[model samples]
Target chain A: MGRQLLSILLLAPLAAILVSLASRRARIAEYATVAAAIIDLAVSIPLLLRTLSGSLIFAHGYVLLDAFGVWVILCVSIVYALSSIYAVGYMRLLNEEERLPTFYALFSGFALTMLLACVMNNAGVFWIAIELTTLVSTFLVGFEREAESTEAAWKYIVVVSGGISLALLGTVLFYWGSSFVLGPSYAMTWAALRQSAPQVYPPLLLVSFLLVLVGYGTKAGLAPMHTWLPDAHSESPAPVSAMLSGALLNASMLGIARFLGVVTGTSVSRFAHAAVVGFGIFSFVLAILFIVRQTGIKRLMAYSSVEHIGVQALGLGFGGPLGMAGALYHMLNHSLNKSLMFYGAGNAMRAYRSKEIKSIRHVLKVFPVSGILWLLGAVGIAGAPPFALFLSEFTVLRAGIGGSYRWVVIVFVIFLIIVFIGFLSHFRAMYFDEAPEGEIVPLPFTAWRTLPMWLAFLPLLVLGLWWPHGLWNIFHQVFLSVMGGGQ
Target chain B: MFLAHINSLQASIFSSLAILSLLLTFVMLGSHWLKNYVYAFAAQSWLIAALSASVGYFSGYRELYAIAVLTALFRGLVLPWLLMRIVSRLNVKREIHSVLQSSSSLVIGACVVMFAFVIANHMSRQQQGAAHVVILALTIMLSMKFLGFLMLSVRDEAVSQILALLVLENGIFLGSQILVPGMPLLIEIVILFDLLIVVACFGMLVRFLVVHAGTTSSRELNRLVG
Candidate 1:
């Protein structure tokens, strides 16, 4: 079951890409991606069920699921399934036919690489997979073939690639330190690094931690190093942007989490915390500032990622159950809300063919379902009541102040308001004003697209309104296990 | 003792050979000719290969020979050949109206080279290794590209821009190659692949600049500045 399930996750996308190569049948290509997504989503369901029961299937060495990997993978698969469906309708409107085939293939490639990255237990393997995702998605970011798109892709590649390079260097240095503890023969597995942290060389470990923090932090879209996020996210197709903002960023975050777990020994954790705290506050403030001044819908969301990643890193840095849970929950909530927003924004882009915020208005009058969904996503992301993000954001704030970082809490509250306003400014322009001066056509909502949205949004509504015990157990187990007996 | 003195002198000679390649980087900053820049880059790679060979002897790392030979073949031979083909096709002469005057560019080049030395010096204080030396050497090469970019940004010629690009590749190859043992092999290969793709993309950028936009230098970066 372990081999089969893992093979299914990895091979399904390759199969889709293989089928996509046969004839220029965009219909078949769309169906293939959607089918691949469904298969991946279905596979993740059993894993999720097992995880929720506090019985996760770990196989292929450390590559198996405990609680944390289970939820993170499930989130990725769910988003992948939805984004593929969204892509079908999204691709139909593209003006260029020449790059469509490559785009479809690359999208599948990105999913395959990200899935492998999410599941890998070995740190080196995980880092390589994340870097591979960057490579595969570069073309997607540049899918439009415009100079701005190319420039965005170029900047994304150079910045992230360089950052990941530092990540590699950091990984090597960390492993070099880990060698002293584990006796150099053992591979640098996540379990080994965490389990054997006491013996790791403190000074070497400190350098490694700083390197990975800066390197992966940049890829995670944290501030001071987040120069690539807005342009890359805003310039790509809305669905591509969705995957990037929703899922890819999280995978990198997960890698950083792995780095944090092992690197933060009792002696060196303070250094890690200081770096995380400094960058987290800076990123949150910068994201708010950028979002407040943004004119483009996609660009606004990109900056919002900077904010969310800040929250996530801050939670990890705080290092307790409440903080970790809030961070994990925010990860999930942001994934759902951001993907939904991108889907809605995809529709708006189709209708208006413009990403400019002012040009798109009265989307509810033109497209009722998408406009409402977009509003819900925006509100959910802004930490509206009963939404998981509200719980996560609030808990994180409590963690910050309880930990005596009152200034962080203040900044967090203020930025939350700024982001909320930025989102609402677009939402109001989108749904409450005059109808857009653009053509309104009934979009090609492939069953893939519509089904996933219904699956995703309805559950979001339910979860926001009530708490599920099974999920609570998943987080509880995660809090107990993934934290490695730490607070 | 006699043999030790001879080896030290040999090492210094090998390093001085490499030093000439680093000097080649500066020569391009003040120099104007495309042929001169390309020739200088080729010489830079040869010196890098030679320096690696010297390090190999000192460290007794046998694999450095293969690396040295590969550098000569790929960097010194194939790349320069490609650049010559491009140079002949474009029939470009010299870069005069570059982004900066030779005097300013020379000054900026010195500052950048000094910055590279400082970074190298600081990093060596942490843990001394060949990696630091290689990174600093590459930094010098990269500073040339940065200076050339300032030139390209102000200058108006596709050929100069491409020459600047070739200089940039010298830096990348040095950095990527030297990042070894400290960096994973996968990353080094990926960096190489990135270099190749960026070259292709820049190739296309140059084509568009020349055939469509009627400008090749980075100077035409005005229309989108808002």
Candidate 2:
């Protein structure tokens, strides 16, 4: 039954894509996509429940869903489901109804591919699914048919496809090395590799892990390979930006984390840890530098996505129960928080009719509710108190200090502070600064638009204040699964 | 003993074909004509197809024969023809923009091959004979991919960059063939089909650029900076 549900979760979106194409009317396409997203969420609920009870590993060991994968699927579906509402509002507001059919088809297709990527336990299947995400999202990124959109899409495809092709080579290397120990029968299966990690040649494993890191790391938006991210995110439509920054990056990170899981308990674990930690730290620091200089509101949010993903990577690299749990929890928190922030930014852009941060001012005076929600989102994302991101960041910091990485923790705190100040500066200017004379032409606002923002933030606040018992159990199980029963 | 003798012959044939493929990549680097670049890529695919077929004959893996046929049909014939149609439609007969002089690119390509030989030798020092040759082929594929990336970064024409992407994909295919010959045929076909779709999308983008922007030069694609 669980396997059947997973298939439905994967295949329903293809049906949605066809339904979207079958209708020429934009309303039909739009409604069809939203219906598909809701069905995806309904399917994921049972799958997550089944996973929490116990992992569902079937399909000849190729399809495995544990606590971590289940959580990723849940969060992705939630974001997609909610963002479909925002997509309806924003795409219509943008008034490009002619593009709706392609948009809806690619939208659901992208979601389906991401879900497929999360479920595949075979490394080869994993890479193919992730590559499909890129191919599908390339069209999504280029949906607007403008020069900037097309150019961003081109750069996106080139850079990400290049990075992931390298990942495929790494998968081959991994198979070649693992075949020596495990034979060809069970080679490249994540469960098999993790079980026999100690028997594999250490040097071969090390090289393969490094290659996979660079390959999947690029897709996950880890710097210094993150050149295409800001352009693609900023140029894409608001809902796509939310998905790319929120859900898609997590799917790719799940790819990297799978390899990380396999390489654990081997001599090369430390090397892989160092590499992930180093990339994470670099991404965090570089994001601050870029965020401080960014003028576009969407680009500002995009850089912050880089920073949060970096923080999650850093937490996982710290490699203790607390750290890995923190990283997993942080993934969920960041997805909601980042998607909320993008939604807010989308509203602000629509009201002001510009993405330039400085062009629109006195947001509080014009759109008071969304302006506050947007401000709270920035605070949450910047690791302020009373939000889930702050709690996750604190947990990771505690783990780093407990692990005797005081210097790294200190540096991490410094960068977090810098990012906080960077975000505050932009937020203050946008919200509190005076609008130019006659620039306060406020567009009419609606509750449906801000409803998703409230829905996203409520749980964020609840989780921050009190970690629910069920979620804690699930997160702990996920932590154990990732650390391979405490390493 | 008979199978072993045939395998030895297969190894030498594989080595020579691998070297020929590497030379064709360099030929692509030195060529100024877009048509020549496409032709060189197609020829390299033919060599790879032959190598796969030979591997199948020796190993008796029928799936590899299927792979060879797919490679020949798709990479050897269909892709180049599609690219040629796009080229004719765009009316770009030859490369007008050069990022590096032909002689310098040739030098760089030679260095890349030598570098691969050195690294592959050191990495596979324990392996003997045909195993070493296969490892060398893998390394050469990596080097060709690196060269393709270099061309992609430096080339100005969108068409040339697309060609560079094809070279990169070909290099990956060769590496996979040498390293994981037992990969599921499902995945192999999916990768090939993905290449087709990506190339088609890229071709469409090139046409869009030509029709809208009046040139297919990626250098003009600077309107989306930071």
Best by DockQ: 2
List of chain A TM-scores, every candidate: 0.93, 0.97
RMSD of each: 5.3, 2.1
lDDT per residue for candidate 1 within A114-187, as digits (tens), equals 88787777777777678778878877887776666765665576567656656765676566555545552355
lDDT of 1 at A329: 78
Q: Largest TM-score belongs to which candidate?
A: 2
Instruction: Tell me the docking grade of candidate 1.
Output: incorrect
Alpha-carbon local distance difference test for all models: 0.69, 0.83
Q: On a 0 to 100 scale, what is the lDDT of residue A246 in model 1?
A: 79
Pick out the ten consecutive residues of candidate 2 chain A with the lowest summed lDDT.
A179-188
Best by lDDT: 2
Alpha carbon deviation, residue A29, candidate 1 (Å): 1.7
The alpha-carbon lDDT assigned to residue A319 of candidate 1 equals 68
Give the per-residue lDDT digits (tens) of candidate 2, residues A279-342.
9889999999999999999999999989988988888888877778788889989989998999
Pairs with steric clashes in candidate 2: none
Model 2 chain B: ten consecutive residues of lowest lDDT = B1-10
